[model samples]
Structures are given as C-alpha cells and as structure tokens.
Target: MLIKRVFNNNVALTEDLDHTEMVVMGKGLAFQKRPGDEIDTEKIEKTFITPSEGFANKLSELLDEIPYEIMVLAKDIIEMATSELNTELNDSLYLSLADHIHFALTRLKDGIPIKNALMWEVQKFYKDEYQVARKVLELIEARTGQRLPEDESASIALHLFNARQDCSRMEETVKMTAIVGDISDIVKYHYSINFDVESMNYSRFITHLRYFAYRMLRGELNDDQNDMLYEQVKMQYPEAFECSRKVQAYLEREYQMQMTKDELAYFMIHIQRVTSREKS
Candidate 1:
C-alpha cells in the first residue's frame, strides 16, 4: 500500500487497491517515510480499514493524540471481545475504546479516578459483557502496570455492550442501562422480591428490558393491537400484570414514552416467570 499520510513513526494512512483508506500500524513502519512512499508489508502489525471518510478523519485525529500502545491495547481487547462474544461489532469501537482507555489511564495517573454509577446494574444485567470487561481490565493492568479501579470494568463493559448494538452513541447505552435498572427496581418493589440474577428467568427478564429500552429510545412502538392476548395475560397473571402496569407508568412518567398493550403483555409474561421463579 502507498502511504497517503504518516501519523507517526509507527503509524501511517494508506489506501488499498479499491481506494479505501486504511490506517496501518507497526514499529518504525513509517520511519523516514513520506506521503506516497510504499509501505513495508513485513513491518505491518495491524491495519484498520476505515469504512467512511468521516471515520477515517476522526481515527487519524485520535491516533495523533493517543499513545500507539493504547491503540494496540484497545485493538487487542476488541479482538478478544469479538472472539468471546461471537458477534460482529461496529468499527467505531476502535476509536472510542482507545480514546476512553487513554483518558482513563491519564485520569488514574493524575489521581482523578471516575466512578461508574451503573457498576452494580452492569455487573448484574450484562453478565457476559461484564466478564469480558473484567478480563480486559486484567489485560490493561498487565500491559500498563496500572490497575484501574473496579468501576472501570463497568465502563469498559458499557463500551463492549454498546459496540454490540446498532446504536452509535454511548449516551443511548447509558440511558438504556438506567432505564433497565429503574424498571427492575419497579418490579422488585412492586412484588417485594429480590431477583435471582443468576436464574434463567431473570436473564430472560433483563434481555426483555434491554430490547424494550432500545425500542423506546428509537420510538419503535409496538402498535399491534393484541387486545385479546393482553386481556388473557392480564387475567392469568394478575399480580405480574399489576407490576407491569407500574413499570409502564414509571417509563411514561420518567421518560415520557408510552408503552403499548402488546409490550405490556410481553412484559407481564417475563415478569410472571421471574417473580414466580423467585417465589418458588
């Protein structure tokens, strides 16, 4: 590949045969190199193919700011997450994760640690992602010799979780997490029961809440008028139905998003399963 730009001695921007921009990385790969110079394929350690010019620009800017090691660490973590999670993540994760870890390390070095408020919720609700994040923390510590606070795991988990979704903004993920926690709280209080987070029913409930929150944020309302099924569920599981109503009210009051009867019916089904399992 011919170099279009050089960010540093170890990184350069190049284009493939299709004229797609890619950031190539290696030790001393760009040393004494100029734009239009041919890249040494043997020295190349990693290449990030930019899907868009906007993304390429943003990534180029980020590369100039953060340490190359941070970029590599983020790449390794993302690769591990992809293998462990068995999912294709958005390419933007490379930029966001590298930026986050760079700042997080800087904050720790300056003794300005940030607390993740959703730590408990993230750990309980996103077990698989959280586990991968914990492993990431260990990886970070091993590479940098900086042991970040446990809360950082939740933050990393959020990044991993957001990477799996269709949403591009981290704010949406945070909001969805908060909504899930709030709805879970409403169910707990309404039924006077604590959820067994390890239970299959509880896992199903959390998954339902996550999708519900996603739909709510996107304004993808369930408009199907399943009146008969709704009434049948309401009568069959009266207590859980009441709890779902409370959750519906909470969402409406707090988020100003109305839940449809179809959503309510499905919500009631999950609630009934979880609460019944908890009681038994």
Candidate 2:
C-alpha cells in the first residue's frame, strides 16, 4: 500500500487500488514521510479495513487532522459502542471524539494543558469514565506542566472504558420483557402463577448479572437485595427454576464444585436474563 496522507510521526493513511482508505498503524509509517510517498512496507503493523466506502471516507476525513494512533483507537471503540449500546451516534461524534483523544495525547506528550471536550455530558452520561479521566489528567499534569480540561478528560475517560471490549459489539442486548413474557406464559399454563412484573428494574438486574456472575460463582450470593429476587424468581419463573436446577447439575458434573443455594438463585436469574436479552 502507498502512503496517501500522514497524520503524525507514527500514523498515516493509505489507499488500495480499489480506492479504499486504509489507516496504517506503526511508528515509522510517517516518521519522515509525506503524502504521495510510498510508506515503508516493513513499518506498517496493522490496518482497519473499513466495512464500506462511506465508512472509509468518514475515517479518511478524521485521519486528516487527528493523531493517527488515538484516532485509530477511537474508531475501534465507536464501532463497538454503536453495536453494543444499540444507539446511533451522529457521524460527527465519531470524528470529533477521535480527534479529541489524539490531540489530547499529543498535548500530554508535550507540556500543554489537557482539556475536556464535553464536561457536562461526561458527568451526566459517564460518571465512572469522568473520574478515571480526571485521574489520568492529574498524572499527566504531574509529569508535564499542563492540565487537560474536564471535557477533554471526560473523553479520555471514555477511551479508557473503550480499552476493554471482551463482549460483542453487534450482539443484541437482552431485554427482560421478552423473558417476562415467556415466564408469564409458561407459568400460566404450568401452575397458574400470576403476577405483574413490568416496570421493574429487570434491565438493571441483568447489567448486574454481567458484573456479578463470576462473584456469585466463587461463593454464595450475599447481597442483601437478592433475598427478594430469589423469592420472586421462584414465585414467578418455575420453568427458569428448572433450568437453574439443570445448570447446577451440569456444573457439578463438569466442574466438580458444590453449587450453593445462592449460586443457584443467581444462575437462574442470569440464564433467564441472558436467554431473553439475546432474543430481540
């Protein structure tokens, strides 16, 4: 591939014969190079092949200015969020957020101040990321002579969250309403169980499942809030209860660990939640 454009010393943009823009990753792709130059074939480490021409063009525009390393990283995360979060991001955010991180890294590399790009929204939509970004800014400031602003720091915090992507990007998020519907119909036929379960924090509980399942596997579920959840599950989801029984039995045969009551309770909870979360 040939170097189509250079962003900084380490990153550059190139195109194939198909005219597809490819972001090349490496330290020397642009170290002493310029646009229209042939990039060192040896220096290129990785490349993100865009899924479409439109995406390629948008990425091309972004690389025109942003630090190549940071913009590349941001692109990966934006793609993940669009698929996982199930919300459409305006194309501008994809461009702007990537630009913010790359430039912020540059300033941090220099002795310039780090600035937050969306301080208020960071506080509202992503408090955990905001806290991490603040700490990162403080450390960078301690090393250099500049303080990154909160909005910019918040964006950094987002990138930090984006660093971990063990889960699927396009996997459909689970919704309890479907499982609720399933549970309702099954129980109505099996034991005539009836209860109104709508308007509950089923979604939040599943979020907790992704976070807490391993902990529950390690030992008993000790969280005080789970007492009611267990009882509710038994009262409402007898079919799910049977599924939990089978899962525990399968674990016993496979893993050779004694499954606690608490573990079984959360097992049913997760199976129901996850089975439903992926349906629609």
| Highest lDDT scorer | 1
Error of 2 at 275 (Å): 32
TM-score of each: 0.64, 0.35
lDDT of each: 0.86, 0.55
RMSD, model 1, all Cα superposed?
A: 11.1
The residue ranges of model 1 lying beyond 4 angstroms of the native Cα positions read 165-212, 215-246, 249-280
Please give me the total number of clashing residue pairs in predicted model 2. Answer: 14
Clashing pairs in 1: none
lDDT of 1 at 122: 70
User: In angstroms, how far off is 141's CA in candidate 2?
Assistant: 4.0
Per-residue lDDT for 1-280 in model 1, tens only?
8999888899888987788888889999999999989999999988878766787678778977999999989989999999999887777899999999999999999999888756765765567889999999999999999999999999898888878845656899899999999989999988899888997778767876886787689886667778998999999999988898888788878888777787788788888988997888
